[model samples]
Target chain A: MTGPARVPPAAPAASTAPAASTASTAADVDGDVGLHHLRLYVAGQTPKSLAAIANLKKVCEEHLAGRYDIEVIDLMENPKLAAGDQILAIPTLVRRLPAPLKRIIGDLSNTERVLVGLDIRAKAAAP
Target chain B: MPIKPAPFRPSLPKTPTGVAGFDEITMGGLPTGRPSLVCGATGSGKTLFAATFLVNGAVKYGEPGVFMSFEERAEDLAANVASLGYDLEALVAEGRLGIDHVHIARNEIEETGEYDLEGLFVRLGFAVDQIGAKRVVLDTLESLFSSLSDEAVLRAELRRLFSWIKARGLTAIITGEQGEGRFTRHGLEEYVSDCVVLLDNRVQDQVTTRRLRVVKYRGSAHGTNEYPFLINDHGISVLPVTGASLSYSVSDEVMSSGVGGIDAMLGKGGFFRGSSVLLSGLAGTGKTTFAATFADAACTRGERCLFFVFEESAEQICRNARSVGLDLQRHVESGLLRFEAARPSLYGLEMHLARIHRDLDAFRPAVVVVDPISAFRGPDLEVYAALLRMVDLLKSRRITGLFTSLRGDGGLQDAEDQGLSSLMDSWIKLQTVEANGEMNRTLYIIKSRGMSHSNQVREYVMSGTGIGLIEPYIGPGGVLTGSARITQVAREEAMQLHRRQKAERRQQALERRRAALERQIAEMRASLETEEEEAAGWLREEELRELVLKQDREVLASRRSAAE
Candidate 1:
């Protein structure tokens, strides 16, 4: 609004795409960093993906204090939200955060790293 | 000024540069994922710097790298850096890095043919893909220029290579030789590369200085000064001239040099940790003996010591110490001292640096000694560069480094060997000056970087016990070489033996000759007697004949003819 103000053209089809997926996954949401509203876009129930879900639950409880939600959306089951986040790879973590959403692409070995990347924890004091 | 607020976003993680003095100079390392061009004239250390970057990436930073050489063969490159302690072959086996050498033959190939350099691109891309390499080095891009005669195509290909490296988001190092009018081969890699580093190997007053300057590094700050660097077993280390002001207060501890007089020359005690000491002199001046004594002292202080004997074997060093009255055998036996013997040509300069670096890492020595550093000077500028690196590495670790140099005749008479003089924190000269009728052994401290040292040349004597510092002797002559004196003594002894043998041989010869002459005279006398008797007989016969002739001259003549 302040600078060049090059507003991106609205792609309305993407807005309606996530709403339909949310209805089917609504039963699983428990309000754990939007676990109720969360969608984990995974290709299949591969070991990498299972590890990611298990790791997410473990990290959320330890750090997020259960004030959030998570919705595991297997792309093999829905296969539609992949285009919504522009997901090119599998096992991506999408933050339906406090506002402007962010995505992390990897098999999260570093839980603290992933959490820090997702803005879950306070930014580390400048070392 | 008001305190500034911290950024809401987390700061990016920093990566470390794997070079020895380089990281310290830059205060960290080059900007991550940016290509840097290392340019220099022949033997100016461009390739060495690039290799150092790749090696440090793999070994130091725990990041795998790729080294593509279009000039030298991979085996030759490996052999060259083998002395620097970079076991690229082993690193390859461990799958931490990949080294591919592209030999561009000028004779067999035609440059006019349309070539795409796709093979090179594929090879580089494949290497990067295999290792997930964060660093890549192309050594001597100039060779490509000569191999491909099309200058316009070569220039375009070079630009493409640089762009491809950046597009891949890899930190690449492209090395080129500086031409007379060009900063790089293809004459333009410098403009495209994110950073440009120039290594200059120049002789100042007959002594060569290898200086590295960062010409330009885009979008990031860098040290723009020409830093002195050394190439040794450890590879290339740029000695940052910027950090001279970073000093630590000295401790008054009476550190011993192991030699009593040498230690006593210092008003209070001995050299401080990180203080370099130079022991320089001509041959037979007892520099090695002095170094051995220092190693012994460091060992006695309950500190680890590494003695690198370039001129003598470790066993010979132990034996020689006996004559000098300083026994280093006990330290070796106790495992307090580790002695490594090497001829400089045993490896390239970088290889030597690496060897020392690896040993230092293993032994973690508090004090290190390079006996007669001159022995390590190879027929290349790399030797001096390696020595500079060795000095930088030791100084950074706050370890005391002692170097003994066998000064040439001119080196001793002149100010100092320009190659070594500037790098020394403290230079001690052990010269055999001819005063009076004999040569005297004198030790003097020419320069001590951070401490006060003895200004006066101290006369010292070596014997079976140890070094004995003497008061300025007021004798008619000094006899230190023990060469002329020992020779003179040997000659007098030989003369005595010669005189005794000559007298005995003369007596024997005279007796034999006299006996032969007497025997000859006796034989001559015997012959004379026989001849005289014959003559007398003839005379008697003649008288008889005359008497008989009167009686029967005709009958005697007939009888004599018939008898005959």
Candidate 2:
């Protein structure tokens, strides 16, 4: 298990502030190949939201250190964005760059499940 | 501190659904600011019911609503309800309605560990605030159970979601799939304890009927009977058989029964206004003729009449009535007469009742006719129940109902009409009396309450002009009709003519006899007069001769005396 060193547990507020801009810019520069684009949706700085952000960063750092980008969206501020992604559960991780979009709900505490959900281990095993 | 009796809470507040007869059944509508569970089997119209509730709230009650569907897309939902005449797209465009489709694909969804439905709350909150909605619909929330793997978390979140909806004070309808025995598959009824409605679409003997029942209504008095509802071009209309009460106000006014002879027979000039009249007869006994005549009379009086024909089309009825000199086509063209024709087998008894209820509401006619109600095929008791409700509905509105029933060839006590007769205020029976090798139509009032009706049977005559009742002709052999009546009348006329001729001949004979007797007496008198003249002449002669003799004797005496 990788420790959540890349994202502090209390950094959801600071990370979600630039989430909208980061999501737009990342979609703008999507010509790069083999990049893992992830978006995490949350409501405010709840423990579940912060843990999901920290755990998702830690997992990305261990599995896809320099190839992944994480964008944290706080639905409390941008509630209208929830409907566009068909969001129903908080702390949902949406894999944006994948050809087939995928959603993993709940706090990303289990590193193995997150890796499998994002199809990272399969790519690593095949490559 | 003595607990001050909880402020004596009144009845639970409700939000009217605006569905026809549904508010009456629920005494208002679903509990206000509370979640209601609408559970039914697949194709049982669960989504339609939810959509109707939301749409009616937005359009009718002026309360904006939000519809969050889990099974169908927003555009698909709008298209599906468009047939019901709900312009959901327009409502949404006007900001009176908000539709959000929550697409949850189990294949694309991956469950990691723990999650809360705060995203759903946020979305609902946003939609509600956008429209200031007072009503919300979470259609088929049970889909979440199939999409997510964690039952415990889903259940907890569902409970919280209901509370959140309540906290917002929005009347919400959450639909669920029917379970094996419970109200819903996921037991959503346990969460929506304020109101639970169950819709059922059942097929019996190849006929499908939709029924709605209020399984449980907390703190409200709702109709306990299963109400048959209809989904037509309008929307859901629940037909509550027990919704009408017996305390409808009655009118003392009288209206014509269309046939003047029949009116004369009914002493009051016609049937009492708003009274139920049953015209029962065997087949070909002119039941439709009487019904059409009554409808014509109502239309002639400028009152609207609605005719429901189960066996014949409207044009056929009009054509048949034209043969009897009833100009019903004119009334139809004038818009005072309307006919609703359908085969009795097209719908079940309750469905027929619901359709009738809908028509009555739409037309609001002053007179209604159900021609040959016996065409309805069902258990006799079920038919009776439906008819009872129909009569109640008509009477409650004070609309005159004329129901024609076809009876069997049995005697006066027709088995099918036994239960219906008591329900009718007046019952006119038509019988076909076979006498003198001819079939004669006869009509009589079996029972006419509150009026002295003629008990004598009159021969029902249908001529080119119109229907008339030939007064009862009680000949030597009882009531004569048809050729027997004509023959009896002819016989009576011939006997009177012969009696007059014989009396005239006897008077002539007596006059001749008297004349002859007078002539004979005159002849006798003439002879006597002649004899008397002769005798007088003789006497005069004798007297002359005597006088002459006396004169001679006197002259002799005088000469003697002179000589002396």
Candidate 3:
């Protein structure tokens, strides 16, 4: 049974401008390309959670350009969402788009690990 | 530069494991509100220890427990513990325990995306909440590594898992497989855990011993040496090598030694009640018989006695004693005397002590007799330490104990060298004295601490009527026994016979002299009678010649005399 209700993220990421530019460029190039559906689960507005959100936006903008969408699921408000994603550690990012799903645990600060874990690019050498 | 010590904090509140000796060794139990790692090699009783902890917590300590097995199923775990007298299903049904089997077959599921162990956490949380459990056991926690492809994630998640339990304030024992030079396979759990307990199964001389050592415990003191643990129907228990403290209550009362005449030599009574007596003797020196006498005395007094025979079977002991008129069967039939006979080599000293303790707990006997205690074959120190602990345990209970040891050719001195004599409150030595081409059994009281006892060696006879101790057979030359004693007694009796014969000869001579004297007197009397007759005849003839002249005078005289 799903325990507790779903709630929206407490705040939106400040790096939305870069993600919008990247998404528009990618959308203009590939007509009706599928959008990346991403969910970031965090316990609260802790530093680790905020850092995860910022890092995910940065990664999406740089890698997926404008063809990605991010959903921040705060476990503090909707802990039952953790059960849906099988989240045990906090600041976990799950990719729910482009067929097979992928999960990256811990803060998304390690760009190489986050990209490699999500299988975005084989050995995505950090620039 | 001098290294600065870490700030020490008070020890964490412990959640008692309830498994025997764990509390005592760990100083209070497992580190509470945190994950403690129990790592061991294969067949080292890791799972059993964890299960016993959970079961004992639920049943013994009145605290509910949740057992989440990553390897075995709930039914399998339950069935396994059923042999240990733990009814897991019943406890589960009664809401005292929750056993959740987390199955992770490599082929069943695919790890396609990012996943945490939220499912396991939820189920564990549900189980704990269901029973209001204060303790949780994750058997073989390393099994989760097989299902995951991400090592870094698994390591981080495990760390998080440990801290998560700490945050929830629930004590947990996470079991793992041991690796070379590492307590666990991953070697990372110990770093995250608050404590690490290592269980080892070692085999030497075809004898397997399971030992437990507390490798690390944060903010607490723990036993450093490896302690042998035992698993049986009664459950798992660890044997602490050191015995109880010497400062214990002592019973002043005395009890009989049970041998025919041994009690008189043990002092006013025999050994003190609650005292431990060691009987060291060579082969065929009546050690078992002496032990039987102790048992008999207790049984006759209506006090329960427990006889632990290591070499002989109960039937054999009973039959052998009956031949010596010990009559142990009647005590057995009456239910006052109990015999537990087994080969001590069948198990380690810990298991033997565990079984003895179990029986003692059930029987509550006033006296315990361990016949041939040295039968616990092992290192001399091991056997001696085990015996010391046993004596300590019985002494603490204020129960009289009689322990017999098979002394070697070195005899009492050799047995005493093992430190057993010092541990005993009373010590008796029995030996075979070879004299006059015969072996005689003799016993002596070596020492009885705090009590006056006889120091003289007493020769004893073991017959159908049981053991009889006589004063040592001392003679003119030296101490003689057996046929030598018989010869001395016979020699003295012969000298007595010669003196009586001499007196009889003198009395016969006196009787002959008296007979002769009587015969002589009879002859003299007869001859005198004949002579008197002759004299009378002669006188008559003379009177006849004068009668012619005297006849008239005689007639006249006769007439005058008649008238007169």
- Docking tier of model 2: it is medium
What is the per-residue lDDT of model 3 for residues B83-127, given as tens digits with 9 covering 90 to 100? Answer: 888899999999999887775544333343344555456667777
Leading candidate by lDDT:
2
| lDDT by residue for model 1 (B240-358), tens | 53444434444444468887666666755678777677878889888888888889889998899999987789999999988877678899889999999987666545546656766
Task: Note the residue pairs that clash in candidate 3.
Answer: A22-A65, A22-A66, A23-A65, A23-A66, A102-B114, A103-B114
Candidate 2 wrong stretches, greater than 4 Å: A1-33, B1-10, B520-564
TM score of chain A per candidate: 0.65, 0.71, 0.69
DockQ scores for all predicted structures: 0.02, 0.71, 0.08
Cα-based TM-score, every candidate: 0.48, 0.91, 0.73
Fnat of candidates, each listed: 0.00, 0.89, 0.04
Backbone atom clashes (below 3 Å) for every candidate: 33, 0, 6
RMSD per candidate (Å) reads 26.1, 5.6, 9.9
Q: Which stretches of candidate 1 lie over 4 Å from their true place?
A: A1-127, B1-17, B41-52, B55-62, B66-127, B139-157, B200-211, B224-238, B241-243, B257-291, B306-317, B333-335, B338-364, B368-463, B467-564
DockQ top scorer: 2
Estimate the lDDT of model 3: 0.77
- The global C-alpha lDDT for each of the candidates, from Candidate 1 onward, is 0.68, 0.87, 0.77
- TM-score of the second chain, each candidate in turn, equals 0.56, 0.93, 0.84
